[model samples]
Target: MAEIYRVAVHYGNDNGFVEYNLETKTIKVDLAHDEKRREAEEYLAKEHTIAVAQDGIRDFKDQKVNAAQDVESFKLALTRMWEAIDLHVDWSRPA
Candidate 1:
C-alpha cells in the first residue's frame, strides 16, 4: 500500500500554520510566502529528494551491487542527481 501523509507548514516569522492535504500516491506541492517560504520549501524539497535518492542508491548497493557496467552507471546517475539537489540547497538562516 502507498503511504499517505498529512503535512502541516508552520513559519517561525509570525506566519501561521499552512496545512496541505496531499495524496502521497501522486506528487503535490502547496507552498506559500515569498523568499522566506520559498527558501525553506526549496531547501526542504531538495533535501528530501536527495535523501530519497540516496536511499535508493543504498538499496541498490545492499542488493549486491557489483562492478557491472550498469552498476557503475547507476551509481554515477545517483551521484549526479544528489549533487544537483545539493547545488540548489540553501543552508542559511531565513532573513
Candidate 2:
C-alpha cells in the first residue's frame, strides 16, 4: 500500500496523526502514542496566543470524530481545519 498523504498535528495536550493510502483509499489515525502525547502537551503549553490555542484545541478535540467520516468528507474537513489554524495547504486542485 502506498501512502499518498500524511500529516500530524499536536495540540491541546493531544495528538492527531492522519495518513491516507492512495492504493486503498483509506485513512488511519493514531492518537495514543506517548511520544506524540508529550509533544502535544508541549505545544499546548508553549502556545502564546489564546485564540489560536483555543481553535487548535477545538479542532484536535474533534479530530477522531471527523476522521471517522467518509474519506471525501474527511478530506474537506481536514483542509478547512488546517486553513482555519493558518496551516498552509497546497492542493492538487483548488481546495
Candidate 3:
C-alpha cells in the first residue's frame, strides 16, 4: 500500500508556525508569512532566493512566487517531504 504523506502546519504562540519538510521529513521554522514557509524550501532545492522557490513550492504556497509558471507542480513535490517528519511538534510528545 502507498503511504500517507502530506504537508501539515499548525498554529503556535505569537503567530509562530512549524513547517514539515514532507520530503526529508524534516521540519523548519519560518517566522515569515505562510508563503515563506514554502519559500524557504529553496534552501532544499539549492536556489538563490525564494523567487525561484515558487516554481518549486508554487502548488505548496501559491499559484505565484518564483519566476516559474506552474504552481501545482511544486505543491505535488512537497508530498514526500511532508511525510518524512512527525508533523505534530509540541515538545510534549513522549520521549
Candidate 4:
C-alpha cells in the first residue's frame, strides 16, 4: 500500500479548516460557517505556495542526484535531499 501524509491548518472564529494531502497532492478547504470564505481562500493560496516551493526543491535535488558521478556524490545528494525534506515537513506543521 502507498503511504499517505496529511496536514491541516485552521483559522478564524468560524473554524475554517484547510486539509492538505501530500501523497495525493490535493487540498480540501472547509469553511462551512464562513460567510465570506476569506480564510479558506487564504489557506488555499498559502498551500499552493508551499506545494510549488517543495516541488521546486525536489526537482533540484533530483537533478543533483542524477548528475552525481560517483557513489559518494550520490550519497551526498541523497543526504541533502533528506535534510531538505525534513525542514520542509517541519515548516509545514500547524503551530
Top lDDT prediction, candidate number: 2
Q: Give the per-residue lDDT digits (tens) of candidate 2, residues 1-95.
A: 46456666543545456555666656554556665444433332231212222355455332222332345544555555444443333354221
- Per-residue CA lDDT of candidate 1, range 4-76, in tens? 3323333433332222223232222243556545544343334222222335545533232211123332233
lDDT of 4 by residue, 24-74 (tens): 444444555553345333423331211112355455322332212333332
For model 4, how big is the CA root-mean-square deviation?
12.5
RMSD of each: 11.9, 11.3, 13.2, 12.5
Candidate that beats the other on lDDT, 1 or 3, i.e. the better one? 3
What global local distance difference test value does model 1 have? 0.32
Per-residue lDDT for 50 in model 2?
A: 22
- Order by TM-score, highest first: 2, 4, 1, 3
Task: Tell me the whole-model lDDT of each prediction, alpha carbons only.
Answer: 0.32, 0.45, 0.36, 0.34
| Model 2 regions more than 4 Å off | 33-75, 82-95
How far residue 38's Cα lies from its native spot in candidate 2, in Å, is 20
- Clashing residue pairs in candidate 4 (N, C-alpha, C atoms within 3 angstroms): none
